[model samples]
Target: MNKRMVLILKHLLAVDDPVQSEHLAKLIQVTSRTIRSDIKELGEFLSKHGASIEPVRSRGYELKITNDRSFRTLLEQLFLSNEPHDPHSPDYRKLYLIRRLLLADNYVKLEDLADELYISKSTIQNDFKEVKLMLQTYGIAVDKRPNYGVRLSGDEVRMRFCMSEFIMNHSEKKQDEGLTSGSRIIHSEEMTLIRGVILEQIQNYGVMLSDVAFSNLTIHIAIACKRIREGNQVAMLSEDVKNFRDAEEFQAAQHIVGLIEKELQLTFPENEVAYIAMHLSGNKWFSGIEGQQAQDIGPERLLERRIYELGKEMLTEIDHDLNLNISLDSELLIGICLHLKPALNRVKYGMNIRNPMLDHIKTNYPLAFQAGVIGAKLLESKLNVNIPEAEMGYLAIHIGAAMERQHLNTRAKRCIVVCTSGVGSARLLHYKLKSKFGNRLEVAGTTEYYKLPHVPLHNIDFVVSTVPIPEKLSVPVVVVQTLLGGGDMDHIENLLAGERKYIFNYIREDLVFLRQNFRTKEEVISFLGKKMHASMLIRSSEGFIGLVLERENAAPTAYGNLVAIPHPIIPQSRCTVWAICTLKQPIDWAGKPVQFICLLSIDKNGDEPPSIMYKHLIEIVDHPEIVQQLLKCETYEEFARIILKHNLY
Candidate 1:
């Protein structure tokens, strides 16, 4: 592609309203034939890539791509990767004319089309027949209506494919011809007005008034003008165009009045003017952003607000570190806006949202640079929600970091030191814990024993208390029992893995469990009894149910990825709800697979479960390796070992 075709695609993408072929031809500086061919070419491009472009009645083509980071990324790269070029090679000229005639807004006069292409009317007719036949292969058909003339309808893809082949043949010639001719016909004022319309729409519509919508609208407006000049009694406006009027039907008529008075330099009767305005107003040809405004803040402001907020949220969620900050200047923001606008459009329209250029953002704004993993996950889970590629990339970074941190820590277990105040003995206790665990056990964050009342007294993988233990704050608090033998570090590694919660920005609703043989229902009660050790009735439909597991909704666990892990971060009851179900076949949870269901209940009033269990759902989903092992496990023992031995957060 070259500059002109790119421009054409841009225009086509921008159009929100349907337009006539005549309008497209005029706007692009091509004969009706050339305009039609371009549309065909565009459609073909969309399909070959597994994307879509649609045409509406009295409107032009609209693009439809799956919404996701990957697609958004693809579209941005496509536009930015290469420049536009000529569509028509030498051999495609014949098909090009056929495309124009077929796609023209109104009926094309056989004589007029033939005269323009320097071919006989019969040749034009024959070309139409071939095009029509091709349409059938794509499951589309040509429709002929009385008074309305010849038209094509049916499967959108077919029309697009046929159109693409035809456009590819002639786009080049049209581009050259368009450049020389378009410059002479289009005025600066017109371009200015068009640009104004686009700016306004972007503000008013937010993401809805997409780039494709704008491009198509521009073509339609230009074509509508041509019909009026050709004595076609086209619609024009009767009243003055206001910013926000309820009687919009008359706006098109008014705009037409403005166009003629300005472009054609003519005046019209009152009724004719009203009809024109009505037509323009009723259709999407007019600017969708007419009443909206965009802030004139420098690019730096836009970047700071959007990038900083996004970055801060990312770091806080993924890493406990809160001191980092990211900032960008106006120059960088301008580039982001220019490049990211297209990327955003693609994502909003269900295309890939990821942009290769995003890598450059780090180089340009170094402070803001964090791995794209978290940012990408945040984008996919909260913004795009379509592509998984970015999210996957993010996961790799997270897991790598986790492994790195683990490697650096002298293979120590975690020990929570508790004390009152005075700072002297507390400091000594902390030093001792660190000295003893130094490569053997890690010292988690420190807190006062008294403050423990307000905080959830859980997640204490191991605790060393200088003072008498309170009734609460449980994790195996070792009363410093003589402060001898250092302390058993065998279980510290497991606690380290379990205590941290790795919140995944992306969560899918689908969960699949892969295991062999169902655990006997009786096992449910046994397991729950061992875990909870509380007297509980076996609530069941027919036979004894597994140990009664209870679930509490102290807080919500709904994250992204269409997934929600609901469990009491802390078990409050001795009775646990143990239930099992073996799907005859796999069922999709959200969009994944589901095989096993685990419900846990704890007696917060008594013994406390490990803090690692607090982040049961989040940690499991975040670690792909763990999820894989769990999915492939064949037995309950194996699954239990995997769950118990490995850390979730």
Candidate 2:
């Protein structure tokens, strides 16, 4: 019914456990009272759909479905409604308008757009202003005609690239659960055939692809086919394509194009083969090729050697920038090398690969993602290519995964599966688990509910089951769908909470300074750096300050609220501590006004992971109210009192 109501329903659908109202409020950046009111209103709407909120006092609320069919119908009506998106919201309306422009076969009228969105012509014009700015990034322009309305004008390739971004929106690898949605210009069967052909070729070439990259390739191929039939072809520099011809993936790409051309009854231009090769090189597929080749051959290729060396340099820069211990991760080294090989191709060809998870990754893993940006910067330094934000997002995925792998290797859980589903279903679920968890989870074994008793318990940390086990067990039982759906990994991560502890001890009274009248970010940072040096916490003040400023140049650490968590690019301090500075008033931090500055300096030789304490800091940062309260605090005890109430330790 309302935007908030839709958000609440989605959350309820996502989780099995009752969601606390406070949790929902924090998630959407609202207050508990607003969530409570929305819940009551949402409950009324759900009642009509054979679903109702089951409120658990002192806990939260859960969605109970009475009629599964009706609930599904309601979900479809709410999400996939004819309105496209909630026109009431500017964001949804912008998205709706983007889709319309991307898919339009003819010029679109401002009046017609207004009518579609149920908005005024003036509003449509204003919205189009934003849309034009957005399309400009893809090198597309709004070409307006008298009485003919407006159409997007750009290079056919750029037009198609822009279209791919909005059309399919890079829907997740899975069928239905991605945050973004895509379009289907052709029949589902045709697309399925295209996907099958691609996969067959990938296997024959002895290469692998991440699911996200695999899905991205499928959609790009589909777009290419559709564009080609309409007399549009990708034109590239002959020299660039020739370079690709030397690549193993170029040969694989030619085979792939030959198969697609035969099946679709179309021909691929010589450069188009290189274009396909670029796609092969850009995504996780290249890394897959690297992985496959490394195992089969004794020595690395020249390109592979370069990639490995460049990757090591990139990681060195990243480690120097972030002071994290991920450079030593062998898996990360291979992954970075693989990701970069194709990424270099993208830069060479002037191609853009949109990363849909870009925003989410930035928000979730600020430090790791920034490290990725620095990594991108390093690649840019040598490659001499202007790395776009989208490419940076793609880089972050690999770096973040590599960082996560370090955690997985040390603290990942081992679990047994209890399934009522048949053997075929059980196998699918097992692979899905592996795909999601990777090295983070080891599957002890899978057994039917009746045979679950025979499954060893001591060796297994927990149980993942298709059916609910009512009896009390020593380990936690995670009941999931037979499909091993979207939110399963998150639920599993929560179960492994015991494995990792938050480093709350990092924040000390000795490190914190309050109510300081700092006017600029530089002043706040300089003051804190000098203090740390004077106290013998840091070896050099200017050196430490330079590292922090360098990191800021890479990306702003001012993550929302009135709080800014600034830290040196690397660990220069003797030990970890939060060198905090609460400004007497708000100061410009990057662009946002920040009243609280938390300068985190990690111990060069510390027991904790860099990201663990960073994650803990984020929990406190999520609460603007807490930050504001801390700003009001003038003494160490008062600040400690407020932070201790969070009970993060």
Clashes of each: 104, 3
* Candidate 2 error regions (>4 Å): 6-39, 46-84, 170-184, 262-265, 284-303, 318-329, 354-371, 386-505, 508-564, 572-575, 581-597, 603-612, 618-635, 645-649
lDDT of 1 by residue, 199-284 (tens): 55335433233453444334334333443444444222233323223444344345545554564554554544443333233223
Assess candidate 1 and give its TM-score to the true structure: 0.31
State TM-scores per candidate. Answer: 0.31, 0.67
Sliding window of 10 residues with minimal summed lDDT for model 2: 171-180
Q: lDDT of candidate 1?
A: 0.42
Evaluated at residue 467, the lDDT of candidate 1 is 69
How well is each residue in 415-460 modelled by candidate 2, as lDDT tens digits?
Answer: 9888876888888888988887787788877899988766669877
Deviation from native of the Cα of residue 212 in model 1, angstroms: 8.5
RMSD of each: 19.1, 12.8
After TM-score superposition, the amount by which residue 451's alpha carbon in candidate 1 deviates from its true location, in angstroms, is: 9.8
- TM-score of decoy 2: 0.67
